[model samples]
Target chain A: MKLPKKVKINEVVLRDGLQLEAKILTLDEKKKIFDQLVKAAVQTIEFGSFVHPKLVPQMANSGELVELISENPNDVKLIALIPNLKGAKNAREKGVKNLNFVFSASDTHNEQNVQKSTKDSLSELKEILSYCKEQDICLSVSIATTFGCPFEGEVKKERIYWILEQLTSLDLETITLADTTGMANPQQVYDLITELTNKFPHQLFNLHFHNTRGMGLANMMAAMQAGVTSFDASLGGLGGCPFAPGATGNICTEDVVHMLHSMGIETDLSLDELLIASKTLQQLVGHETPSYVLKAGPYDRKYSIPTKK
Target chain B: MKLPKKVKINEVVLRDGLQLEAKILTLDEKKKIFDQLVKAAVQTIEFGSFVHPKLVPQMANSGELVELISENPNDVKLIALIPNLKGAKNAREKGVKNLNFVFSASDTHNEQNVQKSTKDSLSELKEILSYCKEQDICLSVSIATTFGCPFEGEVKKERIYWILEQLTSLDLETITLADTTGMANPQQVYDLITELTNKFPHQLFNLHFHNTRGMGLANMMAAMQAGVTSFDASLGGLGGCPFAPGATGNICTEDVVHMLHSMGIETDLSLDELLIASKTLQQLVGHETPSYVLKAGPYDRKYSIPTKK
Candidate 1:
């Protein structure tokens, strides 16, 4: 099980991370983070979600953020989340070329999170899918809570396969399985990703993991062995599931990249720039971030031994 | 690779966890934690170390701890750390049946940590080995910094294999490879454990990992897939390398058990009891412990959705 020579990491700090925070960053603050992430050589970025402002106030500035960034497709690609046709229309209006749509594999979580049943959410996705095609936007579907759900104890693999099957019918080429609550174990991750990749050989897959149970990196490693090469990580470990209580942040991007590079795996991202970006984010949030690499720098940086008494 | 149905976990909270703390636990406090661990069905417990009180005052009471524990072979086996021939003599006099002796794989770490050269440490280990054999005691040798060293940067696998060859000649059956600085990544863990296990088919190997870089559980899983079952965990993630500054605690016992049980692997240990024991340790240490399971209960516990407002 040799890992791929390079893995693509999509930074999601501005969207998934800030969505769960109590304080919202100003327009300039958001732009500073975006520029720093670009400086760090993150090729793909998910910066905003076009949800209703009333539902998630922290993300109220999504449209403005989308309008502010330069439309340079060669240097970097930007992705925004859209829940339904209305959000998709808003994203298109704001010229978001790349978009992510999420539907939970667990019915209870789907309804609670997006206010729609699984079947109805897929139906709603059809409208958004048509809108994406007409607007020439790249759409990537994410199956949230694909491993396990808080309300629904253990999510069956059949549910995920069925959802993926529906997305396959919709002609979506790329899909992501999100461990929204971080209930994934290594064996479960390995088995399920192996099955999914084998069953859908033509479709590209990405993994989004939460570090709630401290299995985030372990699960990512399992997915890597099972042939996954794209992962979504947050700068400074800054995201949590809004619906799941006690859920921690996403796997820290700097931590993941540091480990990967140390193992001779290539990411083409700079750990030093990522640390500087993480520090800037910490200042904006006015709190210490949860980055492991930021706290304990790269593995090569040795701490001087405390002087013997 | 399918993991073994049952895994053996050796709890090192009382010994490894407390030894790094600024405060020390009293004899009664230590006994209480030990009794709870017994009730929780931990088969092997490393209670304390037989080092000089002047060097590590926290473990000065190893002999007393050994004397206090009941001599029931069926209930729980007690293991203690022995640094030199003098510590081995004290452990033998106090009736410790199992002993662990550590030698750093890097010469610099060995010299800085124990104030001995690698050759000198191995020579000292030979005397301790003879004493343990004469006393009819089981001995496990730990190769510290098997993956990387703080001072030495990266440790070569050849060095670890050479050290293991020396211990193998001593007729020892089990050896634990310790990632003392949390410097191991998943690939290195998988490759090394697989090669070591293949080379020494009959020898038992255990992993002692630190969670400093957040790779502890990930490394544990890699070892598990490579056919290594036994692991060393500290309750509430209690221990770290005292000589390695900025290193964190060992992998948390409760968190590991939680993930294993969720994956349908049998550990035969109670998560609830471990949590209770973790809380007790937190109170005794006068600070919140670092166990993820203690923060978030088992994954099956449901979280109510936050109101949309």
Candidate 2:
């Protein structure tokens, strides 16, 4: 039950949340959500991904979105998801200061996601790292399918350890172990995170979890218990695994913040403002989002007493 | 990270899950669901409640449903929810062996639910206790809104401790602290349960949580860390708080069992069969359930890899 007094929430609604959305949000819509997030005091935001427009048409405006918001007065860290060296170059050209390089730990998933093997992805990470250093950009690496793969079932601890061994030497800002398809249980999250933190005490780690199987918040609790203080969450619980169609995406940003604040753990994010953003996103998506706090409201919310007949 | 080796799940879908539903299931439908639960090796089932038929039309057939399922050959513990001595008498007359008396810890909630104050409800519980003893029926008690109340924001820890003090002297089978509105956070659950368990070392306790704000499983984990080994869950995540419209009900039974099993904590319940029951319940309710496992399947399930073009 020991928890950190405060935690960092890296908002990923713009990237992971909107990637699987059908209706491509206009740049104005994306900026509206971004402004709401900033108003909620979200310090870190993954604005969007610098992937091919044909492959993921929803994120086609990542470059323009970054260029539009990079001049904000707030001390917010704006991040862009980069899948390869070309994506990295595109993000840098857009004046994006922070980049998250994602490659699945599972070779099959890595191949499917980026058309490259895990080994090839790692080899490419080196190039991305040197490029980031030369360009004075902050880079973080997210190893997707770190818990289990949709195609490969369980991703072994050894595989994660080896992947860490490769990236631990790099001058990366953080390493995120992602439950790409929401296949992680709490015990697995706790055990793996504990071992990883102990093995790489100097390496700052973040966790990205999906609520696909409804273990998202529980896994976050386990990760927190294992000393992880930073996480990635999507507003309105948007995004989905292509493999698990109809499953929920990342844990809802407002729900996560609500839970943390309720547990007396501070995230410095406003639940009310997050809810506003969540509502806006839901409207933009033109569908009901799987956000619990949005529907149920916060726990401390008081309802008028019913009159006895 | 110290979880119990095994946990007991008390299935409460029949009463708590159905009480709020718009559809009033017939006795035959209840029996079908009961059969499925029994097939899934569920040892404990809250068959139905003995509340006024006009109050909860969905549970109007509780008497007939209990009578039809009580003759089953399985070693299942069938329990019924009773609000007062009258309900208790009705359940006993229907040949129910176990009765659960529920009263809210919040005076406003208790008054609204049963037209009585907290003290009056406790007094009535004494009458029900004597009646159960006279009839040789096992009795348990559930204190609703043990964490917080919709009408009364936060129910103090002292209030819960006071309620426990009043009930500790009674010959109850087990005492359940219910988060009726799903307001209890993990730290609060851990702190309160730890203190209560330490104070009442001889008492057996169960926790009932709703996924109202989506912290149900995380709260369960925290309770387990505090040494609680039994919980109440609903099939297909079926119930909802009357106060919070559209909020999810109790944690899904299959999802809970799936998580426990994944963590290597044995529950002795067949997950596949539970899913079958969940599916049947969904069809009977004529709506998609809030069950994550039913939609996404289990984590161990491997998806067929798509062939490259």
Candidate 3:
């Protein structure tokens, strides 16, 4: 199957990559990385999540970060994740333009994660959606654990379709299906993406994959084959859910970009610039990052010939 | 596209796994692992390589290992790797019933690896083929770097076709195209496998992939989409050429089997038994393996709900 010429890459390294990290990056450090991403021509960046600080202290600076970089010097879309109406109010007060609201397709996961049932979370999302419309703020909703649930296991596709039905009623422009614990397979990815795109022809669909089972790239390729043109990736594969066991990180941004560009698909992000951004992250983390392209250079980097001893 | 009902997998960890390892497993250790594979219902296992001990000290006991396991107690195909006419003679004397010969599609890699030009190695292979025919032994040849070379950047499809033209003259039953340096992408794998399988309808084509750039499982899925069934995998993701820089281990056997089985595709090998074999290898190597299945278990493995503190 032929893929689209250009795919939109929404980088989530700061929000998703740092949420589960032990060493919470300082505000200055976060801003420096944001500047680098803007310089690298990254169109969209998920800066931070507006969750309770007691729950996720790493993202405690979400409001201030949005306040600092909300100017959008390069026309970059800075997205702040809001968990509920309270988080949405906090972001709007801080002048955050674009906001992402997240809920899980699994009722059990939604209850465990947000202390509310899936129905209650949808009600809360509707409140946030109405508030965003009144404030003239751009909004998108993401369904976590869309593929599988760590507690329930093998999440049914009907759950996802029902959620999509609810979001479509709100006339939302975009929706993202996230493999929160990385429990997705290629066949499921292709089948679901095809079904969703066919069912909602007007809404933009994005895919968020974690590399928990080493099927990240394979799943991405399958999605591309199903005509998906938007993806979420982490700069250094930095993020994981604190509650999920053995959830390593998100799909490395540079690695997938390298593969896509090699296949003659455009990601609109420079591998060289991404590597530099990844290297800067290594210094903050005081070790090497978990990126394949960062570890091994681009595909065309030739190997040197060995001299005879 | 629908995949085949079952795919044939050849386990190559015993030979390719230990060849580049710093740890040398004894004969009894090898036998114990072989017994576990047999218990796992593995139909084929590459026991060892009959190469010069001076070059690869780890494979010095190949002939002895073959002599010990050549009885076919479980009806498994015990294959050995032979580099030249001398190694083939060594394997034949040891009562090995099945053998695989190695060469490279890239001329520079062929020269660096076996100290012979491509034409010269083909000539040498002709000699080995004659000997195998006279001895009534089964044979398969692997053309390494069929995708890309560490020394030479990209290998042309024309080069592979030419090699096939030469091998078809001998009426070989099977030929394996190996991505030696893990430099292959999904598009290249899909296009090449589709073309070759269509051109050579009579011969069985096997694909060998390395997880160097984390594209192993992706490439395998693409090959399956192209209608190829046979594959070569390593246990616990062990082995890489000492001469090929930046080349990592082969695709993990348990991981691939887990993915295939989850998709309703049968591989005829038990995942639980493969994990036991992976554990045995870890004990010998004194570290955790690089396998995702060994770490995360299978997809059906359920997680419990979190308790309130």
Candidate 4:
């Protein structure tokens, strides 16, 4: 059970977490959550996504939210999710310095998510890369459905390798292998990550998992065992894939931090402040979020002894 | 990770799962769930507890349920939980062949749960052992709060070792280290189990975990890595500690089997049948259970590709 001494969490509650919710959070609401995240010492955050207003109404205010938060003098890296070159340009114009380009590894899922084949998405990534370079913006890539796909099912390691080979040659800050629908098992995560890290030792990889099947933390443990230190998690475990049927929230940020801190792995994030942010997110969502730490508190929490009757 | 080729599951839904529900199930309904568990090819089941009827109204029918189900000619081992010699005698009167004596490793939790200190419980175990021997009933023991205690906090490994030292001398079928409040983390589980297995090489040990903190599956993975082959899981993730505040369900049976089967580990249980049993439990309880596989199917389930517009 050898694990890393420290790990990095990239909070994505604002973008991926709120994208599927019916209630559209105003810029003020998003800013409130942003301030809480900053108070929690979140090093990097996916603030929002640059998508069409009609396509994803909840994230239509991504540009405005990013613009409002970018003015703060802080070192917290603010990223916006982009599906194509237009999304990247939109985020850049709004002063989002960091952009994450996402596309599914499976052709069927890729087509369903972004209306383009994996090959076409790769071609578009080239243009997005050149555009980001011209705009002096940092870029990353998220290969969704790297483990399995709802439509196609059982995505192969070769497909992930193929996608990574194309993206690795580009000037990207990181490459995230996402279990988009929470279809990944621990063994598969360990094997794929072990191979990927060994083949490309210098490439920085991030893992994004969902707790849809109750394997989120286990998969993260496997990824850590395979030497991955960066992860994408949503506060209060708020998020779901619209295309993936019965999809649940992403691996929760508070729960992940709880596990890591329990196991003596440092994340540099304040658990108490994270719980405050999680409570705020739950209030904003108007529903119970799938956050275990919020409900159960930390493992070290002590209760008073019951007096004998 | 090195995992066993085959793992054994001791289903505890009948006893622990139902004990917490406000809606007490009828004898016929309990039989239905038992039949479904048998249909799923479950080898071991904790049928019910022999506590006082008034203490646990939900399990008051334990005597009747055991009498009715034990008559069926099957190889499935039905075990009853007992907190003291009185409960053991009561279970034996109903013709239960297997009995599991439960006490907590933490003195405060033991006192809260059973109105006795840990030392008193160990002393009572001697009488229960003799009674079981006289009745020719096979017996095991479950040590609650082996990881941590809500009241005392951080139940030390020295305490666990001391408890096991007393129990290992007795003729018990197996011993279970239970995270009664879901406070056990993976590193602690791995380190403790590894050390225990090394020290007590001949003792058969089982792990009981709760998903209260979302570390159930991860802790199970860590235990498996430490060479444990048997576990206690509840169907639909049912069960919680009545005394442990904010306790959630146990590690879900269907979810555990789903993960093991996905990792190429065998449990000799039909996942589809388990899902059916889980669905029955959910309906019988008239609420949603915290089952991941029940809500999101197995990982191998494929969805049809949507036609392009």
For candidate 2, the lDDT comes to 0.92
lDDT of 4 by residue, A1-309 (tens): 899999999999998899899889988999999999999999899998998888899999998887788866557899999999999888888888999999999999998889899999999999999988999999899999999998888898898888888878788998999999889999899999989988787898999999889999999999998899999999998898555445568999999999999999999999999999999989987888889889888888888775656
Q: Candidate 4: where is the Cα deviation over 4 Å?
A: A243-247, A307-309, B243-247, B307-309
In order, the first chain's TM-score in every candidate is 0.96, 0.98, 0.97, 0.97
lDDT of 4 by residue, B1-309 (tens): 788999999999998888989999999999999999999999999999999888899999999998788865457899999999999999988989999999999888888879899999999999999988999999999999999998888898988889988989899999999998899999999999999988788897899999999999999999999999999999999987665444578999999999999999999999999999999999999988889888888887788776756
Backbone clashes, candidate 4 = 0
Worst 10 residues of 1 chain A by lDDT: A239-248
For model 3 the local lDDT of residue B281 reads 84
Most accurate candidate by TM-score: 2
Error of 4 at A61 (Å): 0.2
Candidate 3, A125-144: lDDT as tens digits: 88898899999889898999
Stretches of candidate 1 exceeding 4 Å from the true structure: A71-74, A243-246, A304-309, B71-74, B241-247, B304-309
Best by lDDT: 2
Interface RMSD of 3: 2.3
True contacts kept of 3: 0.45
DockQ each candidate and list the results: 0.56, 0.85, 0.54, 0.68
Residue A267 of model 2: what lDDT? Answer: 92
Of the candidates numbered 1 and 4, which has the greater lDDT value?
A: 4
Error of 3 at A195 (Å): 2.0
List pairs with backbone clashes in candidate 2: B239-B249
Q: RMSD per prediction, one decimal?
A: 2.1, 1.0, 1.8, 1.4
The order by descending lDDT is: 2, 4, 1, 3
Q: Tell me the deviation in Å of residue B44 in model 1.
A: 0.8
Model 3, stretches more than 4 Å misplaced?
Answer: A241-246, B241-247
